[model samples]
Target: MSYRRTTDFLLHDWLEVSSLQSRARFADHNRETFDAVLDMCEKLAAEKFAPFNRLADTEEPWFDGEKVHLPAASHAAAKAYAESGMLAAAQDYELGGMQLPCVVEMAANSFFSKAGIGIGGGGMLTSGNANLLMAHGTPLQQQVFAANEFGGRFSGTMCLSEPQAGSSLSDVVTRAVPDGADFEAEPLGPRYRLRGNKMWISNGEHELTENIIHLVLAKIPGPDGKLVPGTRGISLFIVPKKLVGTDGQLTGERNDVALAGLNHKLGYRGIPNTLLNFGEGKFPVRGSAGAIGYLVGKSGEGLRCMFHMMNEARIAVGLGATMLGYAGYEASLAYAKDRPQGRPMGPSGKDATLPQIPIIRHADVKRMLLAQKSYCEGALALELYCARLVDEAHTGAPDDAAQAALLLEMLTPIAKSWPSEWCLEANSLAIQVHGGYGYTRDFPVEQYWRDNRLNMIHEGTHGIQALDLLGRKVVMDGGKGLQLLASRINATIERALALPDFAEQGNTLAATLAQVGAATKAAWATGNPEEALANATPYLQAFGHLVLGWIWLDVALCAQARAATLDHALLQGKLAACRFFFRHELPRVGAWLQVVTRRDDTCRTMDEAWF
Candidate 1:
């Protein structure tokens, strides 16, 4: 199915996102306006982004001593996206935003993600950066920094990872010191001088926009002049590439931030990823060595503020992974229908005179195609459902909003990690469907696979997400989040039980849910972190399958409701994918949960010396 058709079904038919018009935040939008937005984005993505997906991949960004050079197509795509007014799609009207529902905005952006994520630029990071400042920065900071970022004159990057500290935030050694005795009097906020090196920073250095807004994390020294240890001392800083005046105009002087080098990557090469040096005396301001930065929020709350962007990025990453898988699935499906292969055996035992049939006619080929459909479509539904929850958390009535937030917290890790794992598998199957042709770069499926492989490690690694799900998200708030999630799942189960066609799948899902709950209890039975998290990955896998099962079943109910009016083939296709997932995919949850329930430590305790 086309991206537009899929999104239309999810937004209007399944989620009924148009109902959001009743909310104050989206009061101005109706189905027409929403369709207009999606149509514009779809056209622009096809025109500017799709044609250059391969160009962006083949002609990777290169540095030329003073600046980085990307394909002109990449630059054009970025400019078009900026002009599309989607960066602030969810912001208020006064802020030059459409004030559309979050679900609608997410659906619109899916077009660009599927077209070419690399060429799509850093709009996600820039929007997330502006969103963070709007939430945490002073009013002046918002006007000067966030406003310009939303306007597309400034791009953004979140500088978190360092060469030594990777994902371990507590080990970060970047330091920020007071700029002067009167630093507190600075107009922007508390002024500081940051000196550190940030690694693997995407869009870290680019000329696509007038400036780059970097939200850097660094340590502030204590009274004794020694840096405080752990994340407790970490703080956020607004370190613009070019110093800006009170009027939000560039000061014409460079800040101390410098691009040390670019890290050549395997995929996503269209966007520059760099090692940045702050306050390294490379471009000293006011005859000083340190990079001037304005502090954001209070001290020691950097991670809290940064999580706002991180969580948003995680969901966006999941969407990107899903679209890439969808792209591959469509490609392989098209290929299967056109490529004639071996003929089916006849009762006569020989059919040399008969023409070869399309590969799609083969049972094994159908199995592979069905797997891809189940994974990609189910993941798409899951992401969109999460997006709908974002809308509810922001705009629903008080009690409902609170419940939405709790459910979102419980599902965020799964939303991010599950698609990253399974969609990449879908991409592999897509390539497999193409036979030998899929392995070559000539086909898009291979690149789709390469690009998707990065999602597993993008926002957070699979292991990190697993730990978050089992260690923190499930157990936090006296397990309220998990309980809220269970309630939502059981409600769907009850609905399915009322239908004879879905009653069996409902029972299977209930059993799986119970097994997951038991595993969760068994994992933490001893209250030991090491023991509980020993098989966290397996636990994550099982939990993710359970969530997908719930999502597919829920989606099937929607499709079934429209079966009388919807296109016969489309409705049947949806039902088939749902059945495929329950019969072929959901059973794997049992094996995964078995390992988790037993707190398997075979891999954890194995000595390196054993090798």
Candidate 2:
């Protein structure tokens, strides 16, 4: 299916996103406006992004002595995406935003991600940074920093991981000190001097925009002149690449921030990933050795503020992974239909005179294609469903909104990690469908696979997400989030139970859900973090499969409802994918859950010298 058709079905038919118009926030938009937005983005992505995807990959960004150089196509793609007005698509009208629903915005952006995720530029990070500032920054900070970022004049990066810290934010040693005695009197916000090195920062240094906003996380020293330990001492600082005045104009003077070096990556090579040095005296401000930064939010609340962007980025990463997988699926499917291969088995004897059939006619080929379909399409549905929940959490009635928020918290890790894992698997299968050609760079599927390999480590690694799911998200708020998720899944189960065609799947899903609940209880019954989280990744995998199963089943119900009017092939295709997932995919949940439920410690308890 075409990207447009898939998005149209998800937005209008399945999710009924147009119903969002009844909400006061989306009152100005109808199906026409939404379609227009999608149409524009689709056209722009095809013209500017798709054609250069390979160019971006082949001609990776390189650094000259003074600046970074990306393919000319990368610059054009970034400009087109910025001019498309999607960076602030869900923001208020006063912010130069379309005020589109979050679901619609997500659907629209999928086109770009599918076309070329790396060349999609820093728009996601920019919007996410602006969103964080709007939520946590002072009014002046929002006007000066967030506004410009939304306007596309400034790009953004979240500087979290350091060379030593990696994912352990508590171990971060980056320090921020008061700029002067009168630092609190600074107009933009409390002023500080930050000195540290940040590693693996994407879009950390680029000339695509007028300025780059670095939201650096560092620790403030205590009264005794020693840095406070753990995350409690951490604080967020708005460290712009260049000094900016309170009026939002560049001061024509560089800040102390400097790009130390770039990391040559395996894929997503179009965007520069850099090691940044802050307050390294590269370009000192006012004769000071430290990088000047403005505090955002209160001290000791940096992680809380940064999570706003981190969570958003996690979902966006999932969408990126999903779209890449989808692109591979479509490419392989097209190849299968056109490439003639060995003939099918016959009852009597081989007929040499018969023409070779399309590879898609082979049972094994269909199995591989079906697996990709079940993965990528279902992942697309899952991401959009989460996007819909974002809308609900933001705009729904009070009680409903609260419920949506709880459900979102529980699903966030799964939403990020599941697609990152399974969609990459889908890409592998797509390459497999292409036979030997798939393994070569001659085909795009290999690049798709390479690009997707990063998603498992992006945002948060699979292990971190697993620990977060089992250790924190499920158990937080007296388990209210998990309970809310269960309620939502069960609601779908109740609906499916009434239909004879879906009853078996519904029962299977119910059993899987029960198993998940049991595993959660069994894993945590001892109240030991080590024991409970020992097999957290397995727990995550099992729980994610259960969630995807629910998503596919729910989507199948929608397809069944439109059976009379929807195309026969499309309806069958949806139902078939759902069936394929339940029969072929969902059963794997049991093996994964076994380790979680039993708290297996084979790997966890292994000796350090075992290797």
Candidate 3:
């Protein structure tokens, strides 16, 4: 088995994750269940998904004017994924789900992502869409739209971005007007005529599923028939590709949701990214002028409702980036071990018969491998940590749940952005490890790099996440979330101090935490919010490193406690990675924090005309 697929570190880290879930009332999720789910995912990913990863990239989906055509393997893999009952892994059992913990679902998801992100993206998007409906949709809405999605009979999408609006929801111009008595009303809600264009809609016009349920964000005109400004007036609607009757059966009447065109991507080519004309005259719905849709939550609460999926998608994006890095690392490691090339630097005489050693023996090659290991493994840990926190937020005691929510709020941006930035670096290192061959399609590292590159910009751009981290998350509600995070880190520090093997690691992390706190204070002390946030990106990087450092120390302590019983190499690897991160990666936080705390505005203050 590839090291990426069956890393002991995954089971090691999952120990803590499972423990947290058990304490939060998830009693059925022991190691047996977790490992079973993981094993299933691993097998399915390798057999059904990984074989077609390269194929999917090479044979990108095509639009033949009307329909998007993808490889048969894409649909097959998606059906297998949905049939595994993982689509609703965390949903309630009564809702036709497995009721698995979110962390376990995340771990299982990593395998699919490692196999192929383009294929995994369909499952992730469907899961996110279903989760959102479960969270905020009415019972009828959940039964009609989300249930079929969970059952694999249908697929779902979140449609937010527009050509003009992009990430700025305030500028969205999609309008949803009440359809009146013309359209049939169901138990879900009143129907509306949705007329707008949704750009970058994944799974927008695919034949893989029977129906496509789009969670679209649009604004309803007020009493004056004028749309409200900004996200305040935006509303979420359930727009189906095919009209469904109140009985959840197809009406054979196609909705006015027409396919505008296909947007081919550099990577993630298996899933069709599209521009959808929701209510153009191309397809009329019952002689109606616009697409038929049902409002989701309140009229003006669209952003809030969409946020459920957005946040989930952000974390999923982070996981996608992490898995891509892991895939590259595994591929490079295998190549390094098997491919014989250079001899030792000192002993390589000009003898024509000298035996060439494997590249893994080289110090520089080891350095690159270690870098990838630390980055991919650390990112995986960070994402799982966030997933466990999500479980805590949802299922823990009152105060614990509140604190967990606060801490998750503070860490979400870091969890999303940090892995994206570092894991891409890991993929680069993997490419470097393979040298020339890595750049070519003969190996998978280059494709891994390409696929991961999209993650940095999707969900929310790194810059957007950084602004949220430094400008909003850390400072909101008088920094209660930040304080809660500090308290949790301090608790870990205290626990680590009691263990002799981890005292130094804990102390180093403690010092870094203190530096982060001080830097945050100094940055905000300027009282000029704009100036303080000028170098928010650097602050985000520094803060993200601090969070990773804390998580590493926490994991190290846990590993140390289990060292006697666990595999020796696994334990040593965790400790060594922790040390490597602290010695090499953590110190960079100091320099970044300096730029942050000093309120460096050289870049921000630069005149645009100068460029």
Candidate 4:
């Protein structure tokens, strides 16, 4: 019942998603089934997920030549999860899951991820692949392959990055050729016999489950030789770790994918990061390959199909970042209240005689805690907002879904990167709160730092996200993304202005957004699209704040609405967090705006000649 109050405040005041009292509440679009799923998620997260977090971090998974090792605690926890029939939470119930709404899955993920990311990562990847195959795979493909994953009998991966092609998919040299015998003039589908190397694949060598399903991307040679351009000529294949019979059961022929090496990463060690070799032998129908691969979609459409998985993964990365940061903040808050350390700076004999006060009593400690709370909570809100948008895009009636898609696309990079950046700040503050102990493995904050650091790199490095935001999303469909986002933010400001205690912040946000709009317009006209887009990261960040500020304000409105009916402090806590974010975080925009407008030559000036 100790950390219970804070957790309760987070769920109830900010994200209950069930309450209908607030006009600004997200519940209108949320269905009853969604609420039930969300409640279940929070229940298990607090009960089952959070408990084994430290153990997973302590007992990171390992690997031998044959199988990657995992902790027993993870097995128990995953079993609990699997038994709950929640593995395919986002899938159709017909696919063997509870069919939870995406937003709720994200919220529940907040708990599970906060508890343990390493183990949670496996579940997420499996879910993503199940979703991907359901969307693109044939009926037989779904029955044979994705079914086991959705059923929790297997796990899946999106294998795109090789040691050679980390971010640039165009540079992929992993080759695919025909595999089946009596091949026609040209065989279509995921069965072209894939061969190539895939590196940094999560769950690559794990024995956590019996089978590993890899949605692999590779290049196949044209009759003339040489490579193709763009994302064309790249294809995705459902390449199993071992070849299987067409009858949906396992066979013993090793496909091309083999782990060449495993990376001892700075974080997220529970899932093995692997380098895989593919297509080594001659196929019955066609050419020699170091490993076997079966194509996913038509040839030259691998990146497109992979995009489906990447988009989801991007959101997952954001959620992971949010959860880790939130957990660290929660831990710090607990320590601040319970770990009594110091007296007032100017203390009398009476003060000195007093028992050491909780660190929360100190001004500096409050500052740290407030900062941590703001980022962690705001990041979670941003992530949840995106999740809700996804829900809207799918479930909401007509007009709403279009708006949701636009706003969601605009915020994706910010959603992916801001949490990565700010959550790291939260973890840093957590360490500071723990003093020297945080630096040691004795406390999990240090591990939190290590784990959180990878997020900034993994899904798309912050820089890549920035470039995407600026270069593409901003320009995409002639600035529809930014304009759509502006429309929603404007609407939020308008609504909040009509409410009390929020009018001032609403005006402040409105003005800040206007400034952002001005900057965005200026960048749009800046002649150099690349240069303008170079500033996309900062633009994305500014846009994220506006969006998050809107969310916080909405939460404040919800809090006020609930205050009249519920008489609970949850709403009050939400208001306080909202006020803190607006006051403390929003004003920093002046500096970033200056960068976006003034065009700092820092990165541009760092020349090869200077080195």
**Model 4 CA lDDT for position 456:** 91
lDDT of 4 at 179: 52
Candidate 3 error regions (>4 Å) = 1-14, 17-28, 181-186, 347-353
56-105 in candidate 2: lDDT tens per residue?
A: 99998788878999888988888878888999899999999999988999
- Give the C-alpha miss distance for residue 510 in model 1, angstroms: 0.5
Question: With candidate 2 superimposed using the best TM-score fit, by how many Å does residue 437's alpha carbon deviate from the native?
Answer: 0.4
Write down the lDDT of every candidate, Cα atoms only: 0.92, 0.92, 0.86, 0.75
Evaluate model 3: give its lDDT.
0.86
Best by lDDT: 2
Report the Cα lDDT for residue 272, model 3.
Answer: 88
Tell me the lDDT of candidate 4: 0.75
Per model, how many backbone clashes are there?
0, 1, 0, 19
lDDT of 3 at 429: 93
TM-scores vs. true structure, each candidate: 0.99, 0.99, 0.96, 0.91
Model 1: ten consecutive residues of lowest lDDT: 1-10
Report the C-alpha lDDT of model 1 over 1-611, residue by residue, as the tens digit.
Answer: 66577678878999998899998888888999999999999999999999999999999878898899888898889899999999999998888999988888888998888899878848899999999999999999999999999999999999999999999999898899999999999999999999999999999998899999999999999999888888999999999999999899999989999999998877777789999999999898988999999999999999999999999899899988999999999999999999999988789774878899999999999999999999999999999999999999999999999998888888999989999999999999999999999999879999999989899997899999999999999899888888888888999999999999999999999999999999999999999999999899999999999999999999999999988877787788889999999999999999998878888889889999998
Lowest-lDDT window of 10 residues in candidate 3? 1-10
